[model samples]
Target chain A: MENRVLEEWEIKEMLSRYGIRVPRGIVVESLPEKLELEFPVVLKVSDPRIIHKSDVGGVILNIKNYPDLKEKFMEMKRRFPDSKFLIESMERQGVEVIIGVIKDRTFGEAIMFGLGGIFTELYRDVSFRLIPIDEYDAREMIDEIKARKIFEGFRNIKANKDSVVDLLLKVSRLVTDMGGKIDQLDLNPVIVREDGAVVVDAKMVIIP
Target chain B: MFEHLLNPRSIAVIGASSDERKIGNVIVKNLIYFGYGGRIYPVNPKNEIIYGHKTYPSLDSIEDEIDISIITLPATMVPDAVESCVKKNVKYVIAIAGGFSETGERGAELERMILDKIRGTNTRVIGPNTVGIYVPRSNVSTALTLPERTALPGDGSIAFISQSGALGLLTMDTIAEFGTGISAFINLGNRIDLSENELIKYFEDDEKTRSIVLYIENFKNGRDFFNVAKETVMKKPIVVLKSGRTSEGARAASLHTGALASNDAVTDGALAQAGIIRAYSETELMDYGKVLAYQKPLYGDRIAIVTTAGGLGVITADYLVSTEKGVGMKLAVISDENKKRIRDTIVPFGSAENPIDLTADGSTEQYSRVLEILNSERNVDGIIVYALFQTAKVDETLIDVLEDNMKGKPMVVGILGSKMGKRMILEAEKRGIPAFPSMERTVKAIKVLYMRGRYLKRRYEDGEQGS
Candidate 1:
């Protein structure tokens, strides 16, 4: 029954350990140590205290070059004096699906799958299954969503449905492996690319 | 756990009275009027006889192996009555008083007093503030409602258990109107013992029950309840109507599970895991119960709609496809060969596709013949027939056609008209077709049938039930 939020880097580390794809990233309090090679990178204010970084303009995406990235990083540092920033290279376009695990008191941990991004709030199309579900159950969760048609390359938008299914199975296995140490996990907007699914924005509330 | 409580052969009404206004009087009178063949003992210290039957001044006066005793005394007198019933070696007891834990701390302490008295004895109590059990099979009727307002249901396979007393009676009353019999009904108010888990397990082997319906507000131990539900569903369907889903009730949750996940959503997951069909209203509860009890569970999603009205066929089709707000069911695509059979049977003007309309001039023969074809079709798993009686072509004889036909492949019949429609639907339901007058409701009934069908198929798929 963990109830405390974990840092974004810690969440990514756990996801990577479970073979869930995530952007290669690092955390830093200052701009000096090392620079990323990707041209268009994403810089996120990764303070555990800042649950909603976008709300505070802590997220500066598409920092096209090194100079602009440095200025934007310096500006974010000035606003949040003691905050740690996370930097990762931006990925390509893909479909967004949210995978969540909440430790329900009555039914224990239940896995949730639904359309992610802004459309998630508008449609609220989600389905739930209790944890320790098999790969077949994971596929059912993907098929349960009515908007699943989009996964079949709707309007020339390529998305490998099998990739999403694999992501669900891996996340389920990850949550089950953590047992009671993890209270709730939210991988909102887990982008489904042609080859595999990537955890775009991850948050975990650990059992305290 | 609940056999002795649900099917007690003999019962005694403590605080029995001859007066009409008293509940003691009502219990005794209902016992006799409801045709409970079991021996009835009226324990009244002030009277020697009640309604021409022998009455005793105390439990010690006269008794011959009491199986159940009803305590109708005040809250303060409950402990003494329970002690006396225990002394008489009663196996089950029903406390019909209200001033218990639901009242205040003092009342709670008094209710605890009764619980303390029954500790070492074999006597199990249903409630300190409840309506008790009603089983037509054993001739046990303890619902607070009088016979005049609603008669006890005949013997049937559907059993209902609820936590609300008055609501249980009202639910039973509503179910009785549908012509379905009651195998057992329990109003588990202020559950001291005999929770839903134990009762569900009790029905798992009971030969009389084919389906179980529950009206639950909360679970004493949710994990235990789900465990029992998982086992029970492999045998029969469980229909649940969960009340108090509003955020007001949800806000009082103390645990993180209650706070993080909505009660409604968590309950939905539980229901899905247990293969329970959740009912949105009282109507759907009985509606689903009727279908589950009468028709064979559906084996697939394909359904064919046969109706006299094209608009009704369209309405049912829209409802079937509107899965977001409703259960998504596929309309059966009739093959060209079968389509030709339908086309040849109906009038030339009538459409003979999936809907299989026989026009307003359609005869009862067309309706009957099309059902035979659909029944023999391998693609068709279930059907929804919109038999609107307003059309001159359809008549009461159509009921006979539907009744004799519809050979165990799931079917839902809907009729929308005045008295004729009402009479036809009721009559059709009496024959076990799960008929309704509204197209939306008919579609819902079809959904439940299909749900049960799919469940049964999966349940028996491997030919080996692990449990």
Candidate 2:
């Protein structure tokens, strides 16, 4: 309660309370002798101390088999010995979106949504609203951002509006339910496939 | 600190001079002319008497208790004046002199000297290089004069807090022209001791304050500000006009108020999260404030526009509906059944479908019918009436109809011509209704009201969860 920041797993648990979908994932400090997941899984260092896993080469994606997974896991451990690891099922890509909450000086806990992955930082297209956004407000925040046009079917791909709205609503509800306990929560690269959406990766920081 | 600043009864004007050009002289004149009921003493070592009132040579010589002392002396003399006021146990001091921290390092040192003098004492200082406060209700005008005495001195609903003294003065003048008064006006220049967040917290419990407006350049404490704003907004509407948003603005702000400006993205995100309406311009700020301050909060976002002209009606309706795209609110005009019934009862050719455009040949009776139908319609949450006041058949009769039907519901009137619209505008204001000069402003006001209304509803619902 003293810290307002939530860890990644805690954020996932909170989002689960709001009925948000996330990829099947499990946390482990050490690599298991026998891997349970199928081929083409994604594994990343899940240490709360590490903010950017890809920067440190802690993320190993598209592992085709068990040998590849073992080799990548060993490499990741060798590179970062103290870091915890998370094994998650790789998700199919349709559209990528980033959703987070940033503590603002003038306005309080602001929820943000934008086009995700590299486009999010490169394009810097995002929309924000005050925390505890209702269902209507969540829908509005999604539509207000410039990246919303991409969600309305960009180029040849037909955009999934329902999934985008659903994601925003759930995120809003998550932030609302967490109240002042959560400082910042980032769910990047939320894969919005034709049928549904799943959060592929997340980072949460508790304020001390 | 803000409470002591705003509610001070007895005041002393330092650097009191007989010359009208001096800041001290103007402040004394403003306080006296504005009819400050409390005792006003002039303190000047040089002048024996200022404006025919006996001036005290020093704070020690003054026998009466001073709740607030205004320092309008030179930069070098400010420390001594503050020392004198502190020794006299003055609770609040508003330093109107310039050449403080805003100047440079040397001036900043001098500003620190002033702050050091009042550090732990009960005495709180407002500004060392700033304009001062204005409480029309108390008839306290401590700022430098501009010719805008149009603001009525009564308990008003809007409270304005600005980082810039000049902008605060300008806003006072501008809002006065709109015939709206303010409960309290403050300029928190440099915010050396008092900040916007503290003022907002004070306003949260203020019964006289219905809506709060701010012109902020930077936030000294972002997290503290957010927490207070989030809580305060649940009590009253908070509208912020945040300047220094762009890179150039940030640089300029640093020079203006010594504000370490943050990135625009962070500021925007923060404002959105706080549920505070961020206005782009002074005009928009006042427009939003007027709607939030005067009109009753709307129950829903569904607006029913009633216009005399088809083109104007269409434009109004379009703007109202389009603005709510992201907000997910709907605006539909009165239905055909209600429209036809109104037309048959009032005007036979009035067009249906929300806008309820009565053709050019329509009369006051048609306007009345449209209002009656919209009032009875369950789908309509609010109404906007656009009338061509210059038309031959159109007269005060439409105003009368509006006056009768506009009770317990929010409605805005847009008069076509300014010259002929004055009478109607006055009448509307007298009736506690807002009348805009243009269709664009009318639509914008309605949109703000709708947005604010929705936010308020959400805040209340969220509050219930906590209870």
Most TM-score-accurate candidate: 1
Give the per-residue lDDT digits (tens) of candidate 2, residues B40-152: 89998875677678888888788988888999999888888899989999988888888888889988998789889988887777876778889977788888875454343
Candidate 2, A1-208: lDDT as tens digits: 4543344666676667778888777778787887676667898887766666777787888888888888888888888788688887788777877777666545556677777766666666777766666665677667767767676677767657787778877776766666665566678777787787788877776656
For every prediction, compared with the true complex, DockQ reads: 0.29, 0.23
Q: Each model's C-alpha lDDT?
A: 0.80, 0.75
What are the C-alpha RMSDs, in order, of all predicted structures?
3.6, 5.8
Question: After TM-score superposition, what is the CA distance of residue B56 in candidate 2 from its true location, in Å?
Answer: 0.8
- Encode model 1's per-residue lDDT on B1-467: one tens digit a residue: 66666667778999999888888888888788777887889999886677777888987776488888999888899999999988999888899999998989999898788889889889888887998988888777876676666755667888888898887777677766656676788878888876888888888788888888888888867778887887898887789998867653334332222233566666776677667899988788877877787777877898899988888877778888777766798989998888889999988888878777777877788888888888888888888887777767677899888887666467888888768887786688677666876888889988887777665666565345455
Model 2 TM-score, all chains together: 0.81
iRMSD in angstroms, per model: 4.4, 9.4
Evaluated on chain A only, model 2 obtains a TM-score of 0.89
